[model samples]
Structure formats: C-alpha cells, structure tokens
Target: MPYLLPPPRAAQPQRLLAPTVTHLARLLLTHAPAIPPLLTAILPSSPSLLTPLLSHLLLSHSPPLPALSLFRRLLELPHFPVPESALPVLLRLLARSRRYAHHSFQLLESLPSTHPHLLSVPALSVIISTALCASAPGASFAAAVSCFESAAAVWARAGRSFGAAELNALLRVFCARGRVAEARALFHRYCDAYPPDTRTFNTLLLGFKEAGHAQALDLFYHDAVLRGFVPDAVSYCVRMDAYCKKGKFLDALQLLDEMRKRENCKPTLQVFTTLIYGAGIVRDAARARRLFDEMEQSGVTPDRGAHNALMGAYVRARDLQSGMALMSEMEQKSFGLDDVTYNTMLCEFQRAGDLEGIWKIYTKMTGSGFMPRTRTTMLLMKVFCENGRPDLGLELWDYLIGKGCVPHRHALDVLVTGLCCRDVVGEAYRCFRELVEMGMAPTERAFRVLEGFLKKKREFGKIDEIRQMMKAIQLEEHQAEEEAA
Candidate 1:
C-alpha cells in the first residue's frame, strides 16, 4: 500500500478506426472458421460491431461455424437481441443441410413458442415448411401425420406470406410418403390464402395421381383451368397415368395428342415406360413395341428399366428369341443388368429345358459384374431340381446358404418337392424339418409330395415324419386361434 507509484496517466482516447464492411465481408468469404472467434472478442466490448460482422458472416459464409453455439450466444447478447437480418441466412443454411440442420432447429425451438419476430420472418416460414415435410420424428404413419399438422399450423400462422417454391416442396414430400389427405388440405389452404400459380395446381394434381384418387383428378383439372393454370408436360403425364389406371386408353391417347398439339410437350422416357406397362397388362405387345421404337427415334436413351419392361412384354408373348435379342442390345449399350433380368431369362430357359442357354446367361451375368440375388440362386436351383440334376441343385443350395441367403418358404417347398419326386424321402423329411425350425409351414402340396414319395418307396418311416409335421401344423393353428380369441 505504501509503494504507490506515480499516478497512472489518464488513459488517452485513441482515434477510433472503424473496420470497413467490405473488409469484414472479404474476411468472411476468404476465411470462415476464424471469424467466429474474432467476432466473439470484439462483440462483448463494442456491442455495435456485431451487426456488420453477423450480417457479413450470415450472407457470405455458408454453414456458419458453431452455428448452434453462435445462436445461443446471440440469445444472451443483451445489446444485440436477435439479429432480424440474419434469419434469412439461417433459413437458407437449414434448407441446405436438411436433416443435419438439427442444431439450427433446436435454436428455433428455444425461442418463445409465440414469438412475434418469427412470424414476421419469411425465411423462418420457409424453414418451418421444409421441416414439416422432411423431418420424421418416428418411423410411423401417425408420427408423420403429427409432423404434417405442426407444419400446417406454422403455414397458417404465416398466412399469405410463403412463396410458391416452399408450397411445392411441402406438397411433394407429402405425396411421396402417401399422405394424400394432408397434401390436399395444404394445397387447398395455399390456393385459398395465396395467389394461385400453375406450379401450385400441378403439385396438387400430382398428389392425386400418386394417391390413385381418380375422382379428385377431374376436379383438379377443372379447378386448375378455371384458375388460369396452364397444363404443362408433367401435368399431361399425371393425367395419362390416371387414364391408364382407369383403363381409359383412348382418353389417355387423346390427352397425349392434345399435349403434343397445344403445348409441344414431347413424351419422356417415363411416359413411354408407363404406356409399355399398360400395354403389357392388356396383352398388347404390338402397341408396346411401337411406343418403344418411337422412344428410340425421339433421341431418348432407353434405360435399364425400359429394356426390362420390353423383355417382360416379350416374355408375356412367349417370344423368347425377341426377349434374348433385347437383352443382347442392353448388354452392348452397357445398361446394367439386375437380378430380375437374369431371373426372367433363367425361368424362360428352364421352362424350355434349355440348360445350355441357362448356363450361357448365368456366365454372362457373372462376367458383367452382376451378383446373383437370393431369388436368382433359388430359381437356378429349382431349374436344376426340375431337370433331374440334384447334385447341381445341392451345390447351388450350399453356395446360397454360405453367402447368407435365407431361402424363402417357396424355395424350401420347391426343394422338398424336387427331393420327393426323386424318391429321396429321407432328404425331403430332413428339409421339411429344417423349414419348420425356421418358422415356415409346409404347404398342402408339400404334404402331397411327401405322401406320394412314401407310397412309391413303401417307406413307413417317412410317413411317420409327415404325421409329426401335421401335428405341428395343428398346434400352430390352435395357438393362433387362442391369440385371436
């Protein structure tokens, strides 16, 4: 206390030098992670320095660092209560990150439930709209419905304040998850509250198409026209799908012609695929082929799905040569062949008892980097069994099991039937026991196969096994009845 030095000279006020906004903006653009610490240091001493720093950070920098921490700090900064200008930046970040935007959403939830500031921010409205569509709290329909309700409430509060893009995103998410009722409700709400746009009507029409609600389709068409929402290519596609579903092929063709004449909207690959499927259903492969040719002529590259559909049409027509030809073309074009393609060809060759053709396709599939799926392996095994090659069937079976392919009940049934046909009652009984252990019931056909095998071989031991399987079946039925009661 006695060692007092000369009185410290009163601190002189240095000339204040304000940092240029452009300099701050440049720093944010060039270096994002360093700005947060620099801003935090200056923000406490000179509160007014926050606006420019935050504005620059939010606008110029993407995925602002420590977003959650920064938002919490902003809430505590008495001098810089909620930067209203930064809300848009926050919303944009949320939209980009999607499910990863959890931290930002948590900050939003921290605000007062009825915060008036959030009501005024259009960006906040957009974020809420997206969250409703994208976020699934639990993997259940009820949970999804709850999310939709929450989103609807936010949209209601925003009134006519949201934009067309936000509405379209919401409607798409709803339709994708089969929430058609909610989609319709939101669509109606948008139309009643906001300016009607062609995109808005298109979104609603698509929802009806996805839901398979034929009645709502005509109403949407009329309402869209009355609202001066011109139909586009996508609009025509939706109508086409609807007409096809209702078996109104003539109406669908008329709509297609009208679209071509009025809107110059050319058919897409998807449009042709739909037509092919419809033709296949009605057993009109000729029309399907015409459309396929038209699709090729129009410069649209056929995809694997298109090729598969064509192959399916040929198979339905019993034209194996044509189907094989299309598969060859698919291979030349480097379109990836999936299990379905291989399985289809395998089943066809098996039916024709063309083992050489089957092996050729199998080798080709493996050579082209296509791994055989469980169904493919099962189909091949069945072919082996049917052609009296149990040794080959057993080899395929071991390979599938080793690769962790859990054979389905149908596959087991086929194996059992094949064994019984060869008078191998012991093996058939063993297979039936294994299937029962795996919680699959033997079908009546399996029982008949066992009985026929025992009769042919005069084997009472196999008959005893069959009786045991029947008792097990009866026990399971009784348990199910008790549960129902």
Candidate 2:
C-alpha cells in the first residue's frame, strides 16, 4: 500500500501498437517471438504483409519454429485463402532448416485435400517440385517421391495445367531422383503442351547424367536441338560430368570450348573439379594441376573438393613433399580442411614411416575437433608398432574407444596384428579380448597371430580361449553358409 501511493509513471499501462508486416518481418529477423499475436492479427487483414515476414522468418540465421504454428493459423483466415502461393516460400524455408522440412511435411499431410486454396495457387506446383529435388535427411526419398506424385495427381484432378517454370521444377525433382525414364516420358508428353525452354532440356540432360545413360544424353541433346531449345551452362556441366565418367576427357574439353564459343557458357567451379578429379584418377596429375590453376586464374575459388583432387594427384604421383606442401598452402589460405584431407595426409605420413610427423598431425587433428575415423586410428596404430611404441598403440586404442570411436573388425585385426608383430603377446591378447567385448569379430588372421604369440609364451589358458573364439566364428560362418544355401 505504501509503494502504491508512490507508484511511478513508468508503472502506468501502455497501449500496444499493432505491428505492420514490414515491422513484423524486422522482428522476425531480430528473433522476437513475442510479436506473434501482433502478426496473427495483421495477417488476415493484410495477407500481402505475410509473404515478406514468412520469407524473413525462413531466411533468418536461427529461424523461429513457432512460425510454422503461426503459418497454420494464418491459413485458417478466409482472406489468406491462397495456400499454394505460400508453398514455394515454405519449401525454400524447409530446405534451409531440416527440422522445418520434417514439421512442414506433417503439416502438409494434415491439410484437407478439398481446400479451395490447393487448386487456386500455381506457385504450389513449383514448391512441390522444388521440395522433391531438395529433400532433407529426416524426410525419406520415398516421402518426397510420394509428395510429387500427390501434387501431380492433385493438379490433374483439379483440371489445372502448369506453366514452364512449374514443369521445370517437377522435371528437376524427377531427374535428381534418377527417374530418367519417368522424366523422359513426362518431357515427351509435355513438350508440345508447353513452350520448350532451356530448363526442360537441362532437366532431361541432368537425368541422363544421373542415370549414367550416356546414349540417352546424346539422344536428348539431339532432341533438344530439333525442339529448338538452346543448351545452357547447366546443360554443359551435366554433359561434362558424363564425359569425364566415360574417360572422354578430350571430348569433355571440346564440349567446354564449344560451350564457350556457341553458348558463351563459362565452366563453373564444379565443372573444373569434376575434370580435375577425373584426371587425378587416371594419374594425369599434370592436366589436373593445369585445370586447378586455370580454374583459379578464371576467378573461380577452389573449394575443399578441388583441393582434395589436387592432393590426390600428388599422392598418386608419390610426391609426398608436394602433397604436404599443398596441405600447408590450404592452411595458409584459410581454406578449411575436411576429414578426407587430414586422413589423406595422415596416410601419407604413415606410409613414409614418419612417426613424429604422424603424431604432430594426430595432435592437431584431435585439437581441431576432427575425431580420427577408423582408418586414421588403424594407420596411427600401425605407425606406433613400426616405431617400437606398442604402449602408445594401446593408449590410442583406449582413447579411441573412450571417445566412442570404435573401429570395425578389420581395424581391430590390424591393431592386433601390429601388437603381435612387436612380440607383445600379452598386450595383444588383452586387445583381442577388448575387441571381442566391443562386438568386433576378430578375423582368422587376428586369431592366428594371437594364438601363435600365446603358444610361444606357453599360455595354454589363453590359447584355449582363442581356440574357442575360432570355433564360434567357424560355426557362425557355417550357419551363414547354410542360410545362403
């Protein structure tokens, strides 16, 4: 009562101004969840305001999950009847956040099929098509395929015909999923029905590459020419990938030149990476390096994949210095190294029998939050054994196991083999026991190595245990053979 007598003016009730769509979009960007009520009130009266707000929400660094709930509520408003218009934006948003894709699919399934908005919005056709292409991990490929089928069926039932853009989206989804036959059939069915565009041919070309049907690609290219569709950048990229796979590097290079001359198509970073990788595989490190430099000079930034391809070229040539130098250059340039790059370098170090170098790299990899994978662990274990550091190998085994980075049976076999080679029979048997406990089936080579060590030491109990494990393994193999028969 005493405090109320002296209440400040700040304590007085203040009127809340209803937020405009623009203001709400800004709030969404700022990640303000408190503005949903204001948003809900304005959405029905001004549906136009919702698009930017929804787009902003979707594009936000940390998007609001509650926006999905708000979107559902907004759909209930009579003025916001065009659900299809919202679909493409929603799909783009879903693609950005995997969690959104999971929730959005559920929301989509809940919507009534008879809703008038389903038929009214043409943009939805594009959304469904894009969603099919950019499917997330939680959403199964089958689910995406089902969604596409449902959308196509819905459009047909509604007597609605899609435009080139929407058809392009559907075609892309089909092509991406490797449904080349289905995509081709749809292309022929819809070719005369709509004006053939660059996108139509691009989809067909991508489908051909995805399916590895090089013959089909030639047919489609010829068909595109007859249909008066000009090949674009995407078309050239698809063809380059196919040509590279077929080891037709000269043909691939020729196509690049033709694309530059006729279509004025500049090869993208991905195109260059594909050629470089293919060249590396064929041990043409010189051409691979040439392409790498050309890619850089052309103002294309080399990504990790490109860098890895160059490293592979160096590795294949057995030029470890050059390979290591490339790794140093990657670090200097602040080009992030992935697990593959680190693993490759580690393998090279192990092969060189440079234990100190391997240990330094191992420390750096672990410190940088790059957990050593099965192959990395096995390589390090082998290095330790060769360097007369069986104790270090045991330490590594324990560390990897503690970190939940348990190796496969093959890796365990390699470690046990390393231990046995060092004549650390007791340590080797201990590791074998741990491997078995970890559910790794010690291979016959691993068992024989451990048994030989135990036999030399006259450890009869350990020998009998090893024999029991061998019998169990043989029994399982026999049972598997019987099942197969």
Highest-scoring model, lDDT:
2
- Per-residue lDDT tens digits for candidate 2, residues 1-485, read 12111111222243345564434654433333344566666667776666666654443322434456567666676556544556556656655543345444455544545453454333454445546555565573455556655755666655667567666766676787788887777777666765667877887898989888988898879887886777777777788888878878788888777876774667788888887877766778899899999987888999888999899878777777888788889988888777688788888776776666677776677566455655677677777665666666776666554333335556667677777777777877887776554434578888887888788889999999878876775685576446534
How many clashes show up per model? 0, 0
- Residue 161 C-alpha lDDT in model 1: 43
Off by over 4 Å in 1: 1-141, 148-182, 189-207, 210-215, 343-360, 372-485
Q: Which candidate number has the best TM-score?
A: 2
Structural similarity to truth (TM-score) of each candidate: 0.49, 0.51
At residue 334, candidate 2 shows an lDDT of 85
Query: Candidate 1 residues 1-485, lDDT tens each?
Result: 33111222333453333554434343333343343465555556655544555444343223434343454565566555455555555555455443334444445545544343553334554454445545565443344444444544665654524556656666666775556777777777665555556666777787787788878888879886896777877787788877777777667778767866875678888777776766665667787788788887987777888888788778777788988998989878988788778888888787787787787786676456343765687777677677676545554444433222334556666777777667666777776665554334667777778777887888788788777877886796676546534
lDDT at residue 484 of model 2 (Cα atoms): 33
